[model samples]
Target: MSTHFEERSGVILCRTSWGSWYQTMEEVFIEVNVPHGTSGKEVRCNLGSKHIELHVKGQEIFKGKLFGTTVSDEGTWTLEDKCLIRIVLMKTNREAGNCWASLLEGQYCADAWVQDQMQRKLTLERFHRENPGFDFSGAEISGNFAGGGPDFSNLQK
Candidate 1:
């Protein structure tokens, strides 16, 4: 059967200006694909120099070096029921390009990382191919509500 996941290298929806790629707020996003049953404590993302290491139980699950700007300190993640980790990486003016253009450039990831992802996609495709009567589950990749953003405005007396 067809699963809910998409075979994506990386999908970066930049909130840029219409005229030019101007991000009013210095921010970007990172979407991580987590397995069906993953706990919040089990997942860890160490961000440094546009590189990220996803670890579960102190073991690296996914390792890839992003080609975009450095991941800002300000960001949030939502882990949905299906176990998709959506991380919104806050960006800064210091970094260069946004996420969308960056990930497309090179294969800056490990073979295991690439193989694991490809296998997942292939498995789904195979299931559909084999089962003629199979239908999609329509399972959406969602996340839990962590917290709100920082208050930029001044407090009233």
Candidate 2:
């Protein structure tokens, strides 16, 4: 959570000395930078249900537990541009609003945008509680309401 992350198109991204990683609600994508002429044969990547180990040219790039469980058998990796190792990991949990706080456990945290989104949801829920008959679950509050809060005029009840 070193304030070195950004959110783009709903994907949270973080960069490290080795490379970068981004995640959607359903999957985590990692890109590791290797030597310019590195080949797939020089890469060693192991995907476990709760851990991952990646090595390039016999050098350990990363090896640690993941932030969340993933379907290891469905995970895949490939060497692109002869210098980049791209990996795709499918999450075991795909419930709505489910998102990883980071790629690795206790590592980089979610971007501020994600935190803001969560805050907005909490604010909406508070408004809903104060104004019954109005359903705010999953509601996206954008712009300003007439009373400077959630518009309850269109209450369900």
Candidate 3:
């Protein structure tokens, strides 16, 4: 249902799901855990071309315009580790019927990267493993895109 990213004294949790209707977007929620007694009182993020909204202590912090897929933004902040923590909600378009369908569907290659406090950078190379008969239509229709479905006995190998 979700994936967890953890490290010493901190954790980054991420959960994603498909959304309703013609939109059929993938929604992602993230929570970052900081260490105790640290408080600069700010938060920063870099969400590339996905809608995002922030909240702290059960209160709305920032509300930004909803840009379908063209605009992207980033921010940084300092805060207490024991604080309520920060959450980022993001949504991206589905691959079906879209221009990038084949590529987004894992038929191609993707590149990714990450950085740590030591300024060390990690690069990743990825490719999609083919699932011949997998039906993505259900995810395109219903908001529940978590991935359990009927067997693909009908799909040709």
The C-alpha RMSD in Å for every predicted model, in order, reads 17.7, 9.2, 14.2
Cα RMSD (Å) between model 3 and the true structure?
Answer: 14.2
- For residues 19-95, what per-residue lDDT tens digits would candidate 1 score against the true structure? 11112123434455556788888878776557656675577655676545555466566667756666555555321
lDDT of 1 at 79: 68
Candidate 3 structure quality by residue, lDDT tens digits, 1-157:
1111111112211122211111112222333454454344444433455334444444444445443442243322334346534433333442222112111223221222111210110000000112423422222222222222223347885
Comparing 2 and 3 on TM-score, the stronger one: 2
Order of the predicted models by TM-score, top scorer first? 2, 1, 3
Sort order, lDDT high to low: 2, 1, 3
Give the TM-scores of the predictions, in the order they appear.
0.41, 0.65, 0.26
For residue 66, give model 3's deviation from the true position in Å: 18
Residue 101 in model 1: lDDT = 38
Candidate 3 runs further than 4 Å off: 1-26, 40-42, 50-81, 94-157
User: Relative to the unseen true structure, what is the Cα RMSD of model 2?
Assistant: 9.2
Q: Pick the candidate with the highest TM-score.
A: 2
